[model samples]
Target: GAGVSQSPSNKVTEKGKDVELRCDPISGHTALYWYRQSLGQGLEFLIYFQGNSAPDKSGLPSDRFSAERTGGSVSTLTIQRTQQEDSAVYLCASRTSGSGGYTFGSGTRLTVV
Candidate 1:
């Protein structure tokens, strides 16, 4: 894809189950980010990957949430032991440089019951 792309646009899962969301960033982009947004809420940063430097996972709400960007392109977000509160739209964004514009994916809506 020319722009950021996310897989499994919608997911419904039982409580305690786990889910994995994928993102493919634009080619040559050196920055990638993951965020979550609940119903009528603002986006909350989850993690960030920039070049070879360490990923800033400080925004992750819990240890159960994790993400990784591989080969500086594709990224994945994993949520363990999903709970009702974990239900939300996961968004992925990427940028080619610090001052460049960003491209965001449509997001993956997760519903936990």
Candidate 2:
């Protein structure tokens, strides 16, 4: 893909249901990131994957949230036992290097009832 792509732009789930959001980043990009934005809140960093190193998972709110990047090109974010507080727009971005600008996907809007 020429840019980042995110699947199933919108999702509505029961309070306890789980959901998986996918992201396909630009080819050759070495950095991938996940972020969350509530109704009117600023983007909150979730996880970051750079090259072959371990991902930074410090931003995950709880054990229910997890993300993984495969082969350094694609990624997935999973929400387990979702809660209403989890409702937000989940964004994915990819960059070629630390100093480079990020190319962001449209994002997946998760709605937990």
- Name the best candidate (by lDDT): 2
**Residue range 16-98, candidate 2, lDDT tens digits:** 99999999999999999999999989999999999999999999999999998888888999999999999999999999986
- The positional error of residue 32 in candidate 2, measured at the CA in angstroms, is 0.2
Scored by lDDT, model 1 comes in at 0.93
**What lDDT does model 2 reach?**
0.95
82 Cα displacement, candidate 2 (Å): 0.3
Writing each residue's lDDT as its tens digit, candidate 1 over 15-96 gives 9998999999988889999999999999999999999889999999999999988888899999999999999999999998
**Which 10 consecutive residues of model 2 have the lowest summed lDDT?**
93-102
**In model 2, which runs have C-alpha deviations exceeding 4 angstroms?**
none
